[model samples]
Target: MKSLLVVSIVFVLIIIQGTTIGGTRFPTSDENSNEEYTYVEYEEEESSEESTLPPIPTTTSRVILSTELETEGPTIANEFECPTNCKCNKKITLVDCSHQNLMQIPKNLPQSTVYLNLSHNSLKTLNVNDLINCGELRQLYLNNNEIGKIVNTEDFAKLPNLHHIDLSTNAFKPLQGKEFSKARGLLTLILTDNKDIVTSNVPIIQTEKLKTLYLANCSINQLPENIFQNLSSLVALNLDNNPLNLTQGVSAFKPLTELRRLFIPTVPRHIALNLCKNLQVIDIINLSLENHDISCFLLFNNATYEESTIRTDLFKTPTDPPSNSSIVVSTTAPTLSTHIQKGTEVLKQYANAAANQAKTTYEKMSMMYMILSGLVVVLLVAILSVFCIIGSRQLGREISYRKQNYRKYSAGNVTVENPNYERYLIECEKRQFTNE
Candidate 1:
């Protein structure tokens, strides 16, 4: 009976231990004399099977710990946490963190980000070293920022894949020395609206792939003779709103063979035409043409004979009598009036004859063009027919020869015959001397 009671007690203890903390033993404090408290250490046996079980979720612990941290929320200037009320769709790979009153870049950003927009921010300076981990970042917009100067050119050179950049409206006064040489794949650059940025001595000549460049409103007074000599692939350039006065003989833009757009405002139409000879469009608003020749309008009202300096000797003279003969010819007034009327009718007949001549000339030119077009079509057809006939004859001869050769080889049982065989073949025979 005692043994049965002992087995029951052991089974109850096993069930109690297994019921709490995944079978981990609970420690009891020892209350001995003068001692405040002491924990009873119990070394629980680690089951190999227990280790195979799925890990317990620690989310509850994390939530309890976070509650204890007493974090209110993200503040305006805080760079660690996302701003409150900002909808951050976790699925988007490019975050528009621009114009958000962010004094610094947010920390712990997702590593999958390939584009980051920090433009129109209060960031005074950017440490490019911080972005070395973002190797996949291809585009970065830093325009309208308070960036004063570039500290290290090598910082941006490390981003090998960065292609497009917009650093306009910054305080980069005078760019210097291979600043963009590292961005080998950079195709477009916009540095416009930086009023104090005078000279761009950046070694952009090494960036052969650069195509579009915008340097408008940079306070540039003039462009160097070889300013664009290295950008062979440049297609568009915006130099508008500058104080540049290009000289008449200055061919500084001759090297830009692929340049399509050259923006220069307030330039004379004639000068614009000459400066951009290959240009398809020119935007010359508010042009001042004070000394432009106005002789073209003067000849608009001049007679054709006077314009061409033609002789008037062949033109018909008026048959009307002189004014002084009116008084003396009063006795013959009826006869004089009849002569005047006849002269007026003769002039009208001459005008009608000239109009008919002009109409005939127009019809003749139209008929000539029609005849020429027909002749050209006929000539082209004849040439095409001749080539077709020659090609057909050559093809027929080749087909016949191929068939004859194919039959001979097939009959000898040396080669297999194919119904669709259309290729040429050559056979060689060995020379041997027979001895009798």
Candidate 2:
């Protein structure tokens, strides 16, 4: 009777077990579907949040060129007859005899030569006899030579049409007594890299038509007062790489009323302001200033201040006075301080604009870095989640397989007479039959 009762109970448990196994299979399928849904939701949320971020600034298509073209090309041969150890153009208007070991000027040059280059040679002195015939010469380059002194002022003064001269990198002595007076029609002069002239004051130049002067890298310490008084028409002056003491007076440039461009040495802010007060072209390279001076320079706005300070005349037009009656006209111009203030404002504006551009570029780079960092982090999290999910599913499957195997072995080892063991055996056999 106990065995029979056990068989009936076993039969009931087999039916229930089969139903529970079927129900457990539905849950695994549901878990798989939930995993897919979670993945889709995570991707949508990530994309939607990232898309809401502000777009970075970009250059316009109109400004960006599609392709870049190179301007460099191979050299072409000249068609004109060139002199031995010299180069000349097709029209024979210029001659180049540079880098040659000759001590004297080349003879029998074309009569139409207007530009002559005899630089980088072993010449020590310039003789009048050498250039007496080239009257039409306009530009002469005698730089990089051993020329220590000019033979006479009259030798260079002979060329009435000479306009430009370059005597840079030469060892010249202090010129005295009306030197360069003959070359009064000259427009430009370059005497750069001459160390001897820096020891003493250079003699007053008397060129009436001289417009440009370059004395850079000359090691000059001080400029004599009224040094530029005679250069009324001078437009550009380059005094860079000089060692002018800040304590000394800088009145040398005061006489340059018509000067347009100035390249002075690094000096105190006050001195630089005083020297470049009236100039239109001022280079900031040679300026040495303290932090407070920079603040002061940036704070002053000359244009706005000048406009407010200046008073406009109420009367639009004055009635014409009798020509013979003396009508005095006020000749006073704007003060030097006004001009200095105005120039400083322009430089400050340029500096501010450059600073703003740099800040914008930095911000853009930071944004890009942040975006890349976020993407890397998201990718790592996604990979870790995938690995974790796979590992958990594999562990669950192993545990379930081990439990089933343990039940099967225990039921097979149970005593045949035990009703409980018999009941478990029936359940196991029924499960295997269902699987089959």
Off by over 4 Å in 2: 1-84, 198-204, 277-436
lDDT of each: 0.48, 0.53
**Quick one: best lDDT, which candidate?**
2
**RMSD of candidate 1 to true structure, Å:** 36.6
Listed in order, each prediction's TM-score against the native is 0.43, 0.46
Candidate 2 lDDT, 20-94, residue by residue in tens: 222211011111211111000011111231222111111100011112212111212343334567766555556
Q: Write the per-residue lDDT of candidate 1 for residues 1-436, one digit (tens) a residue.
A: 6445544554454333223222211111111112221111112212221222112221111001111122223432223343342222233334456657676666655444455566667777666666665565566667667776655566766676665566766777565535676666676677767765645443324466666676766777766665666776666566656667765423566666666444443343344444544332321111111111111111222312112111111121365222221112112212222323333344345557778988998899999999999999999999999999999999989867766556434436566665533333323122222321
What would the TM-score be for candidate 1 when compared with the true structure? 0.43
Runs off by more than 4 Å, candidate 1: 1-88, 107-109, 200-206, 248-250, 277-436
Clashing pairs in 1: none
Best by TM-score: 2
